[model samples]
Target: MLTVGLLGALVEARRSLELSKPKTQVQWVDLAAPHGPVDLALRLLGDETPAPPSIDPGLVATWDHIPDHGAVDRMLQQALVNAYGFVVGYTDAMHQVCRWIQVLAHPMTQTTNVRALLVGPTGVGKDLVARTVARLGRRASQPFVAINCATLPRELIVAELFGAEAGAYTGLARRRPGLFQAAADGVLFLDEVSELPLELQPVLLRVLDEHAFRPLGSTTQIAFHAQIISATNRELASLIEGGAMRADLYYRLAHVVVPLPSLAERADDLDLLVRYLWRQVDDSDPPEDIIAEVARRAWPGNIRQLRGVIERAVLLRKTVGSTSSLLDEIKAAPAAQPVPSGTLSELRQRFERDVLVSIVQRCGGNIRDIARELGITQRSVYNLLKRHRIAPGK
Candidate 1:
């Protein structure tokens, strides 16, 4: 019995040691630099090696301690990447959306008389910002109703916005609340507001002014007090000039016009957004050159194009294990094989002159640095500058 007791004690001691011993030395690679949340996680896990005894293991007791580990971070990152891509991805998806909150609180946007309009190119996150603001507004608990003016038939536009009474129209069998009535004291986001037909504009204007609309076949009016946010990609000024949009409705809805900038305008934010998205996909550090290549491309579709490019790159990266060749292939593709009318000598002269001028300007008149950057002798750069009729700085 004593021998068995001793054996049991030994087994217990072994189990405790196994439980206490560091399982596997977790080396979290810092994808971002120092002070980055991901880097903080890496530091807590120790510096790419087994954690020292002096380090506190309790620091990472919860996954929330690691910024990249949270589910919200993953979901938000993916959504931002898929929805807006890099560059304007985070800024457009989050920062611009958040601005609506501040705008809602501002005196100009808070007044009952003032309406807000969000204007930008399609897929530039105009509607997304409106929906996000509505979700975060004080009336979050109330219903949020959204109507796409462009999608509604002209005949039903009034009924959709102001409800219909029983037997009011051919198909109206029961009383139904319109979006505006259903969203009372909440929010009504009208997308593509410019598409609202010219004939129905007066009714919309009346609703904006009186905050009340009578259902079809009903003499009594129903009151609706909902915040109205409108969005459009079309140029309202042009539309008004063309007599497509009501000037009065435009004035009322554009009390606070927020123009969202394109992704190309905020290219510097691409790297940060790329890292954020990579982490979301549970990917380690992506090659720096791949990110640089993405930054160089001109995304005409703006954030939407960037996301498609990234999705392709990620898929290629997974299958090929290298993005350099993919980048090279993209670069090597013949650039529209130019019209084929110019002489080689003429093109050469034009190219040389342009390059020399650019290098000189970039050097800020320092010929030495210009020569180094261009990988040529200082005298050669000076000669090219002279040939191009450019004066060198003393």
Candidate 2:
């Protein structure tokens, strides 16, 4: 019995020593240095090595906060975020959205209708912003109708926006009020505004000009009092250039433009966002280990993607029964290899090229959407296309 006890103690000490040894020999790079997040990530991971001690809980806890601006309209901003569920990050890009939301709170004259546009990458909460704006408006009790223009068939889009009379088309057995008519004295949120068919652009422009739309097979016009709020992942300027959108229509729809940052752009908000999303998926408090792991990733799909992954993690936790095991499972999963490093300019160019390619692929080679997602002017996007020799069609 004495020999067996001694043997068990010796084995435990050996296990502890093995665990204490560094798993990978990696050099540290100041994350706040001039390097981009991608570069910093590469340096941290170094040639198939495990992520270093940077995954510490303390690192996850240290995130920059939005500083107090003495006279900022923080009440309205907080109300929109907390009450209305408009989760924004601390990045300057997202702060700009907050500023715009605050501006939206100002009372508008009865005669002057509000028209707002939200532009950003897909799933960056454009719809959330539009809905929140509607809730914030004077017509909060009235209907807030939302439509995805892209999902509608081109033949049905016009009818959907401006209702059709009975027997107006093959499918029309009865007259139905359009979205604009339904949202009377309220808000009409047109998500994917760029997808509004080119043939119907003039009709929309006319409605914006006169606040009236003509139903199919009807000579009389129906008056519309609904405010218009649009969200899109595409650029109107490029769309206009391509003759798929109208400049006049763009002028009417974009009275106020608010752009949101991608999730990766606001890395500091990862912990906050993760914690918020975890509570949404589970009743328990957010586990620090999961938050740390999530922070280390590059969430290309932005907030929507982050939320989805966390929800899945929460689902897995039910079976795994502990945060540590879930994290171990995540670590065991295969991850993509990093791009090789080159000179500084080369790295920048490579990153730029990669971003352009990725956006183009995701958008199916729509330059307008690419420009919008990259937050660059269409002209700059064209210039990059020329420099990188990337054809817009793939």
Candidate 3:
């Protein structure tokens, strides 16, 4: 009876524990029975862990909206591309210019008085050659000031050459510097040196002699430290003989005279120069036939004329979209055709007669264009017609 009572107490305790505990689901099968018995149990668990948040759409959109390059950036990139495509050709004159530049850049040459003069026909790239030399020299960083003496009148030439102090003249309110002083420690390119007034020649001579000058109305003398490069289309020797240029100044300026070949002389460079300018247009290589045609032409105006023709051709190509036949068109142009064969003297006389007739015809028997074109001070267009014995509108 005591054993039965102990068993009943144990069964009661197990029933109470099961009622207090949380239930968990579990599945089980009884091994002893043929039919399986399955049981399910459930137990309490902690809250679920959170996942990472997604990125904001606006931030992603903002990054995608930014451009890889801006307008100005694109322009600069194109310019660089065009510049790299620019082909500078090798010629005897070009080689000379390069040699001069190399000599100028030499350590010993910079401190010496090395003056150079460029003599060539109009539009033959004399100024360009001088500037190129300056660009490649040791003084590349220095200022390069170019002055055309022929463009300035005689009265103002002095002030332009040497600076004036404030109140030096009626127009002088503020103290100003001249080209020589302005080009201090740099280069001063004097174009049309033969056109400089005879009176002002002394001032230039003094500068070359003393390397010093006084501005207008200033008692103090200022020292000028600069290289001088002068260019002229006129024959310096003839100008000196004609009393237009001082003989002493001519000698001083002509220490090294670089005679630039005309465009006709370097017809080979025409195509190269044309292609260069073409590439500059839109960074696109022109058709080979166009370049060949350009090379075939005898550019009368030299580089300048070549540039103009190429520019027109480029514009036409852009509009018409056909460059294959450009050569024939260029060859057919009036200027491209060669003049009839003649001796040098015969050619000059014929050209002169033709020019005189054209002038007379255009002026209605007046000579204004011929006079102005020839840069003569006294002769009028009518006077030229009278001298040439040509009738107008005949």
Candidate 4:
């Protein structure tokens, strides 16, 4: 059972996700009341109250990033550059994302929920771009929940998504709302969607098509009003070809596909990225020569690797002098390597094992908490533990 404190926190979080935007055709109804679930359930049983005032999405668009228009476009561009610390680059890829956001916010498109897919290599800021787009939408002030699909096990995917009721499965002692319901009036970002299991794909498809889903143990269906922004480092076509993904679901989520350029493809942004990363690591301004030197490398790990390099440099500077040459260190470090290709089943199993192991270690082998967080039954958790040779905590 949820502790009184925990339940209060959940209610507070739900309140924080309520929208500031006026009602639209696809606007989410905040069924949660000011009090706890019992009050909310009672209130929901009453006659539906009239929705709040309606606002034109076009008016909301006034704050959006207009790709190629006028003063608004320029301001949006400047804001993005500042927000990203000018590391996103001035490439066409960035422009395309901005353009897609404008189209996504149109009154016609805004009449329905916007489901966007971001495709690119890992560590290329796909999640960052998605969040930026969400920030530009009418639901900017609402919650922005991001889940790494690649990290979730197949058995827990459904539970992590739609939530579960008490007695839904072994280990679930109380009801819990999933990411979809938690992000009701906002954006729910599913990162590395290419890793999603084929079995759960249809469940996601149903929710996307019908905007409704049943909890793990519930008869009543819940409405899903959050905009879904999915990202993947791998090609969906390849996943579909290998029977690892569903084509129908792909088409639905890919309505607005924004492909991010890899770091190698946008070398021009390296200097800005270095400087930005350096400032984050060390509060002081990075030397121009250091930034220039760091920018000349072929960063195979993309921004994620680059950030690590900068962080290491900061440590080295503290230990040695500020003039520490990192070239030798960079050369000694293993190059960014691609994951070896394998059969879909083999790859999925390995991925699941690794993710489960990591989470188990992080959570200190708390089976109940793991089951709750992963949205799986205790039986599934035990199965994973047995498969991976993990000993559950006492």
TM-score of 4: 0.62
Question: What lDDT, from 0 to 1, does candidate 3 have?
Answer: 0.60
**Model 3, runs deviating above 4 Å:** 1-88, 319-329, 332-394
Q: List per-prediction Cα lDDT, in the order shown.
A: 0.61, 0.66, 0.60, 0.64
Candidate that scores best on TM-score = 2
Question: Can you write out model 4's per-residue Cα lDDT over 300-387, one digit (the tens) per residue?
Answer: 6788888888888888787887655675665555543444579757966787788888788778888887877665667778877887
- lDDT minimum window of 10 residues, candidate 2: 33-42
Cα lDDT of model 1 by residue, 286-364, tens digit = 5688677666665556556556556666777789876776778545533322223567468557777887777777788
C-alpha positional error of residue 198 in candidate 2 after TM-score superposition, expressed in Å: 1.1
Clashing pairs in 4: none
Residue 310 Cα positional deviation in candidate 1, in Å, after optimal superposition: 3.3
For 1-394, candidate 2 gives per-residue lDDT tens digits of 1111111232332233234323322221333211111112112122244444545533321101224321122322232254345665445666666556545543572227768889888878988877766665566778989999899878787788888999989977999778888889888889998988778888999999998999877888999998888888975765676467888998899888887777756776777678667767687756777887777766667788778778878887787775665677556644423435687478657877897888989988887888788655678778888989999889
In model 1, which range of ten residues has the least summed lDDT?
1-10
lDDT head-to-head 2 vs 3, winner:
2
Clashes of each: 0, 0, 13, 0
Rank candidates, lDDT, best first: 2, 4, 1, 3
C-alpha positional error of residue 160 in candidate 3 after TM-score superposition, expressed in Å: 1.5
Query: Per-residue lDDT for 1-394 in model 3, tens only?
Result: 1111111222222233234323211111112211111121111111131211442323221212334313222332233222221222434554454445445544455568588888877887767666655564567688888988889867767777898899888878899898889888877889988888788899889989998998988999899877888999875653554356789998888778876767665554565566567766756766777777776666667777767767777887889976546566687755455446887568655776687687656655544545555454223445544555666554
Cα-based lDDT at residue 285, candidate 1:
64
